[model samples]
Target chain A: MKYRRSGRLVDMTNYFLSHPHQQIPLTYFSEAYKSAKSSISEDLAIIKEVFEVRNVGTLETAAGASGGVTFIPRVDIYATGNLIDQLCERLEDPERLLPGGYIYMMDVIGDPLLTQDLGRIFASRFRSAKVDAVMTMATKGIPLAYAVAAHLNVPVSIVRHEHRITEGSIVSINYVSGSKKRIQTMSLARRSLKPNSNVLIIDDFMKAGGTIRGMMDLVQEFQSNVAGVGVLTESIHEEEKLVNEYVSLTKLTEMNVKSREIKVERGNLFDDVYQI
Target chain B: MKYRRSGRLVDMTNYFLSHPHQQIPLTYFSEAYKSAKSSISEDLAIIKEVFEVRNVGTLETAAGASGGVTFIPRVDIYATGNLIDQLCERLEDPERLLPGGYIYMMDVIGDPLLTQDLGRIFASRFRSAKVDAVMTMATKGIPLAYAVAAHLNVPVSIVRHEHRITEGSIVSINYVSGSKKRIQTMSLARRSLKPNSNVLIIDDFMKAGGTIRGMMDLVQEFQSNVAGVGVLTESIHEEEKLVNEYVSLTKLTEMNVKSREIKVERGNLFDDVYQI
Candidate 1:
């Protein structure tokens, strides 16, 4: 179908956004819109400028027969900081404090827009980690991991508490459930990851980091390397730490079950040598 | 930061893609880009044309001081069919079959790019659903639910098998676990959704449709409506389906455990009044 120039731009923009990290030849758009190659190039030029100025991403164009444009996503430091601050304020609500010094954050986990921002923050922090894929324990972390993988254009590998027939051959590992302090089993499909691949670990919350450690061990079992670790929120109140070299978007400093009070601060994401 | 015309177009496009269904005033773009309102309007015109031609979505622009732009996501029927066909091919892999006629589909569920397509397909089918939220059972279905929610620009509600301290007060429901024919429990946080909501339910796979029915029942408990039900794939071999008024992207027609073969076909999505 033939399209007007205005419609073409909108469609092309969405296409680039959804297919980030992909190289699409100019001719593809030209033929799709039934436009000249020159017009497509001009459209891409505008997109490239807007993306760079807004920190939405970078657009790299190759010239010649195989010439194409690739969109690379980036996060604005100002926007990232604003998102973190808003999340901190949201978490500090008294009602979010549960009995036994725990905080209820499932609402945030179930929010797609919030998860999208959190994922972008993680992806930005680990942009140089060369992460081939994202791995996470099942349940709350799946959305976050999927978000990060979406931004990074990678697959998400989920480790389940139990095995299911749909996963085919599996690799199971025994790990200490951080909060419970009990040995629990985590399993991943044998075909989920290739040996020697670089994996990034993501989780919604980290208490003692035992679970993260277990995941690292599981990665080793796959002959994969843990290139980086990211947690949406980490409890800094723990007197001991079992994991390191990880980044977080927020920190839970204190939670009083009886008083229904909670203290939340920015996570280690801001401490890095990141551009603001 | 002030930007050039091209820069503004790219940034504007990204903004619209990320914040669909929400309106942003033309002045906002003009001020950010340091461009005239007319220039901004012209840019939007180009975007509108591209979006409509590609069927990426619809771009609605309102005039007057309070008027702005809104991005409404859409799915091209041709693209949707191609995606379903590709997924069907992937699902038919001999390795995806297991004993007892169960099909292993974790790889497809775990893929973010493909899930994005699946989500768009769901979003397109239910565009008129007025979906207030997307709901799904925990584990494999969370990603699909989250993706659908992303397209709809809404929050996702995850029903879980077990309770976590971080979820606060929850409403628990009992239902048959579908394929297993055993009684199982599902729970959701009370505040995850508001009353009288129009919820779109998404699942990774369906067998007897018992779980979907259970979810519809649960929605009633919250005084909410089941706007629609969508499954990534459904099993056609099931002797009976306990649920109706649902759409699926693909169907598992047959699974041969002995021969290690699987037959997959287009699902209920195409059965609807969809345009090609």
Candidate 2:
């Protein structure tokens, strides 16, 4: 149904916000709203201005019949820093420390508001060139990967540590846990991913890159390329990293299991993105 | 920091859209946007008009101290039916049929856009009452529960089949798996939920409500209350169910593994809500 400019603005904003990274033909909007192509273009121009000035995202427009608009979600550097600082504060809480030096991350990963920003920050830095799907291990990694996939408008493939009856004809692989140095097996459904697809891997936490490397190996099993790897937090506790190419939002500087005092620093997000 | 009416309108709309079910004081907006409280109120009025007329949700304003605006997301009956039909079509795909009477639900659960709407529909039905948090089991139920928690602006507590060291101290319970009619165990982190908190339970699929019932039993172990139960799909193959009170989005009427044929019907969603 055609709507007034004000109403159209609300509708358009919601549509773009919900559908990121996917190109939508202008004709689709024109026909659906019963408006002229020129009018739709004009509407987009105003929406674009608000989006940019507000740092909401970048609205890329194509010029021909096949041309359309795509929303590339982004968060400003200033906002990114502020968000990371808040997250670090939360991570530093002494109560978050478990008996064996594990930080309880479920509370943070379980919140949609925080994960939404974390996902956008990661997506903003990844293979913006082409990412067919987002990959992560089951349970903990699901939320972060799902959030990134949502923004990228791609599917998420979750590799399971345990086999379930629902996932038919699975591909299983064993990899060494870089931390404990123990071998573990991970499985993915055969049909979950397409061969030759580009996948971005994300996780809630990374200590020695054990699980991340495992995911990379699994991606290879599917004949998919690991476009990039992003972690919410990377432990500096591992001096020699098993994986070299990765971007983290926060780095654990110290965690005195004795005193329950913790220290977290801003990660390599800015250094990897805005810096050379 | 200040913006004109159009600019402020855009910002406020996005803010409300993202922070659903949370109250935002007008003064906070006034201070941030450098607009008068009256101006912020006026902008919110316009947003409320669009939101209500479009059936996006209701914008409620409280009157005095602790007074603010809250976005109560709701999907109109027509839109709800359309969403359910689309979901039914997807669920009815012959390819989704798995061996041993299970439906491959990963693809549908992994889509953020579809999941966002599903979450909203579930939230609309439950927001009439007070809900402290959302609860679901590990693995398949994680994404669905997370989406619902996002809409409800509550934390999601995941119950795991086995206790993970990362979860720290946990409370484990055993219950009968209604489909298999075998006893199984589930556990939740001790600190995940507060005592006497009201919780909403959501899952990806249900046949005999074994898992749902297990979750309910787990909630009681925490001294919490089961506010409601929602499932994406419920199989009709079971002659009897272990749990009675619940809402499901789609009903799987037939699943012929031999011929790869599947049939799905409109679930108890509308029948349970509007009909009553």
Candidate 3:
């Protein structure tokens, strides 16, 4: 069957978007479309042009018998800035202030579009990092972890506080809650991570980084390495943080429970130059 | 600057894929690309043809002043069947069998690609339903819920067993665990769902449908309606199910803890005719 250029372009674009970070040989498309290799190359040229021009992502091509093209998903600096600013505005709502200075953010975390945009930002930041899996604590961080995992084309490994019978064998760790100073336990299934794999830890919110520290420790238990850390929001009011190196999208600057006042600022995502 | 047909096609395809279920006016593309409406119409014709032939989605055109095109994502029957068969094969592994006949499904649920496929299947099934939000219990059900919510362009509302101060005002419900006959508590934030909203419930697995029943009751507590229910796997060995109406992808027919044997089959997803 002979496929037209228009059809191939549409199909190829969809293929690249869905299979981000995957390298596809030109011969694969050539055989599937029953077209010449030259024709497939021209089609990829058009796709690469559009992807770059629109800031959709980057298409890196390799020239060799064992080479192909890879689609690296990225969110451009302008889009990332706009998204973070919007998140800051949303987080500044006084109604989100709880009684104990805790900000209610389930709605923010639950917004699929928002989380997807945030995920793309994180994916762009860590596009060059080797991530075998995206890890997060259960309950709240699952969505953000899955969001980043989807963009990076990796599986998500969830850490849970309470052990479940269906998890088979688990590796449990006890850590101090950074702010409350209360001891908490976090566990991961034994089969969740492979040894020596590079895992990216993600969460919705962080204060003193206790949960993220616990996750980092859990990753070490699996003999895995922490490739990078990304958080949706982090509290700057904490006297000290347990974990130091991480990327956060938004920062909680202030929260007054008595006055029901809350303040938010853009996180340190763009403090350093990043290349995709 | 005027854009070429190739660029317009690539941009339009990406837009439709990203903004599923959203109606885009022909003039919107025409204006963005600096092309005539006739040219934009031709582009849409090509996109619609490719989308249908590829089973990517359906592009419905409305003929009126408010007329435009809406992209409804779909997976063809062959692809759906192949995915389900793969899932069944994966589930039949004896190593997944845990104590008390429970199958360890963290890997399956943690799989981003698998959950996205299952989410697409559920989204296709519930394409025509009026789903205001996708609801599910936290921990296991979150990934599936986010997957469906992303495809449906809706937000997700997570239900949790324990309440946190970060959730603000919450509504709690007590229900009997269908298999264990023990009362359990589930809570949802008051802001999660609006009154009279239609919520689509999704989960990873179901034995007696107790968790789903609890979710349904929780939805009622907020004065909302259950738009639909979807489960990745359901246990057919159960004597009775608490919920009757649900679409399941795979069925666990038998399990033997002593023998470490398990049996799985395709669920009733294809038993009924569906229209995209």
Q: Which has the greatest TM-score?
A: 3
Show the lowest summed lDDT stretch of 10 residues, model 2 chain A: A267-276
In candidate 3, stretches whose alpha carbon ends up further than 4 angstroms from where it belongs are none
lDDT of 1 by residue, B130-152 (tens): 89999999888998999889888
Taking the tens digit of each residue's C-alpha lDDT, what string does model 3 give over B1-276?
Answer: 578998889989999998988888988988889999999889889998888888788898998999998898888888889889988999999999988658989888888877888898889999999789999988898998898998999999999899878888999999888878899999999998889989999998888989999999999998999999999899864477999899999999989878878899998897874642
List native contact recovery per candidate, as a fraction of 1.
0.78, 0.51, 0.85
Each prediction's TM-score versus the true structure: 0.93, 0.95, 0.98
Q: After superposition, how far is residue A203 of candidate 3 from its true place, in Å?
A: 0.6
Off by over 4 Å in 2: A36-39, A273-276, B36-39, B273-276
**All candidates: interface RMSD:** 2.1, 1.5, 1.0
Ranking by TM-score: 3, 2, 1
Q: Model 3 Cα RMSD, Å?
A: 1.2
Which regions of candidate 1 deviate over 4 angstroms? Answer: A1-12, A23-45, A60-69, B1-5, B30-39, B61-68
lDDT of 1 at A112: 91
Q: What overall lDDT goes with each candidate model?
A: 0.83, 0.85, 0.88
lDDT of 2 by residue, B151-264 (tens): 788888889898888877899999999888899999999988889989999998899899999999999999999999999899975468988999888899888888888889
DockQ of every candidate structure: 0.63, 0.63, 0.84
